[model samples]
Target chain A: MFSLQGYGPSILEGTYLTLEISFVSLFVAMLLGICGALAKLSGSPVLRAIAKLYTTVIRGIPDLVMMLLVFFGGQVIVNKVGPLFGYNEYIDINPFVAGASTIGFIFGAYMTETFRGAILAVGRGQLEAGYAYGMTGLQVFSRILLPQMVRHAIPGFGNNWLVLIKTTALVSIIGLDDMVRKAAMAAGATRMPFTFYVAVAINYLLITTVSIYLLKYLETRYSVGVRRE
Target chain B: MDFAIIASNIDIYLEGLKNTLILVSISLIFGLVMAIPLAVLRTSGNLYVQAPIRAFVYFFRGTPLLVQMFLVYYGFGQFEAMRESVLWPLFREAYFCALFTFALNTCAYTTEIIRGSIVATPHGEIEAARAAGMSTFLMLRRIVLPSAFRRALPAYSNEIIFMLHGSSLASVITIIDITGAARIVNSRYYSPWEAFLTAAVFYMAITFTIVFFVRKLEKLWQRHLMPLEQLDTKIEAPSI
Candidate 1:
């Protein structure tokens, strides 16, 4: 009664795709997040203002709405610009690219906040000490600031990651064929949505449960030699 | 680029706005009402009492709300018994399914938030309440719940905005919330920007409003934690 009906391989492939989208988007989000954190923390007011606006607008809008806007609006913009470039045939944006990038872009705002707070949590004296030892600006950042910030950023980063994983489910709406979409298709064919969705839910639970343990291990690893009250 | 499409569809957007607001508000109310008891039970010492609630919270919080909504809307229909049950009528409607999923989702998060705050309630406060000769129920009612609610406010506010945003999923299931309206306009005129940008604006306005009110409530509730000079200064006469 609880069989996968020969869709086990398909669901496993979908799960792999889900994780691929997650890691790719995580990489994008982290890149944007670091740049954004630096921008916000920079001495320049214009950089700070741009960072502020990016975080505010992105966080205020829903992820699904942002995905729709970027996916469809982006297609229109690309095709319109294609004509001017003398390539006027229709061009469709890949759902995988659109979905990953939109999730990354939306979560980048969140990652900015997380990274900014993490950076601030590092002591001013530590950076001063690094400079006092004659370290280059890049040296101080990589050797001093980045290491300590990981400990502070882990909790918020983990939270963002879990939410991002869930947000990937929305990509199925735009036809990305993630596990949620795969489950939907399987359910449609089998006429047993309860079995299929429950399977999908269990898959998500496994991923999240594994993530929680890994995050805890990282937190402890990074907290070595630091005193905890 | 087509302002005319958006201008012509303003009423549809407003109707969608109404549905979105209704969905969010109702679910929030139900979630909070349900969460309070579950949270209390979650904090209990008995393993039996806490275990079931823990599993409920874990399942709801672990999975995506979209999946939960689908599990309710589509999954339930798979069972012949559920189809024959009296609850089938309510479960059949997309609005009900969305509300059921959202309320359970928010309730899980809310329970966790309230649990954290409850656990963090100052030991001194609990000792003081005990020294006052209050019963456990009385102490909880008078001391623990109030302070926990205050402490939970900031996190709870985030959950509220999340629920508001999550309500957009209702459109996926055929409910004409703001996103649903945008989807319609986009499909009708094939103009994504006008349709979605308007939806984004509506959502941003609501988000800001929620933030604004939560800030005000925090100020009012956390007034005692404020400095003496800041207290009651609003009643003072304006400087000449």
Candidate 2:
């Protein structure tokens, strides 16, 4: 019999926070990813160079380092900048905002690659065809390119998401009350770290497994009307 | 911005770099050795034989490395039996605990990578080995594993970089890796940018080095796939 020792509610709350951070970061990542992808694909040399730099640096550095750099460094920068303004008081960055943004910024690089490849996979002729029909660039993108890119993007997007969910664990190190941190607190109180850590791991497994199923369903949905071997 | 703190703390960073290199190298070596056999078993047709290995891979890949590291470092000590066991001494040390956890985690990912390559080995090669009167074991040794290893190199290199990055987690349990060094420097000088940015630079250096070497290895191993003119040029360059 595994017992939470009166810590069940707290663990549940941590799990909720973890999910919240993951989804918020996912949203930010997707937004940046699209912009980065377009910039990379764009004809402007400067935009391409900036996007290239973003992906290269982010991918090269570890996520934890980025998180710490953003969290602690951002706090320092904000406080330093505060005195320049009318507000002179020391301002602390919220852990939630810092954690989510850091994760998003880091994963944005990965998502950029995924989206770039997916957009390229949608073929150039289709967009040209849309143009031939007198469609605007936005219309070609939304009506033709976006729909076709989804199927190609899903596999890479799904992989990024799984990694992103796991990356949320790093947020706990930044003093966020995610399930891992909650588990740590409970383990410290009860001296049953094995039980609590295993419990947290199982919760992660459940989320990932469900996400895999949903991704598979989405893949199938998007592939509808397309022939498969 | 504070170069003075970083300059003063270079020795500490070097010591942390040494620990990080030791951790990443040992785990990667052991992980690769463990993965080969596991990968072969994973590619087996028997459901019973495959299921256990599948589950092992699933569990490792499905969970976060931080949790796994904590489980090995702190969770094991929670059990009375583990405490009294001979392994307790090793588990008690953060270094060994991190090495053990990282090796297992990398082993799982490497197994899946190797398994994919193994399964993708051309059927013609296997048939030729059979046609030459080779036994299954001999064929696997001579034909399958070599090609699989070659194909697996690119993916395995990525895993190595990942392991190097993951080794930073050892700092959380007090192992004083590069990240740990940065944390100490940050706390001592209250210079987060100087400390962590230096750590980030070190990590980026290692990552680029790995990428460079892997690219070289790929070029070497995949030479046969090059076009005839390029291969001829490569061969004749030294003689000329």
> Please, what is the whole-model Cα lDDT of each candidate in the order they appear?
0.95, 0.94
Candidate 1 lDDT by residue in tens digits, B1-240: 788998999999999999999999999999999999899889965999999899999999899999999999999999899999999999999999999999999999999999999999999999999999999889989999999999999999999999989999999999999999999999998999999999999999999999999999999999999998777556757789
Model 1 chain A poorest 10 in a row by lDDT? A220-229
DockQ of candidates 1 onward, in order?
0.90, 0.85
Each candidate structure's TM-score, on Cα atoms with residue i matched to residue i, is 0.97, 0.97
TM-score of chain A of each: 0.97, 0.98
True contacts kept of each: 0.81, 0.78
Candidate 2 lDDT over B130-172, as tens digits, reads: 9999998999999999999999998899899889889989989
lDDT of 2 by residue, A97-185 (tens): 99999999988998999999999998799999999999998999899999999999999999999999999999999999999999999
The alpha-carbon deviation from the true structure for residue B202 of candidate 1, after best TM-score superposition, in angstroms, is 0.2
A112-177: candidate 1 lDDT, tens digit per residue: 999999999999999999999999999999999999999999999999999999899999999999
Model 2 regions more than 4 Å off: B232-240
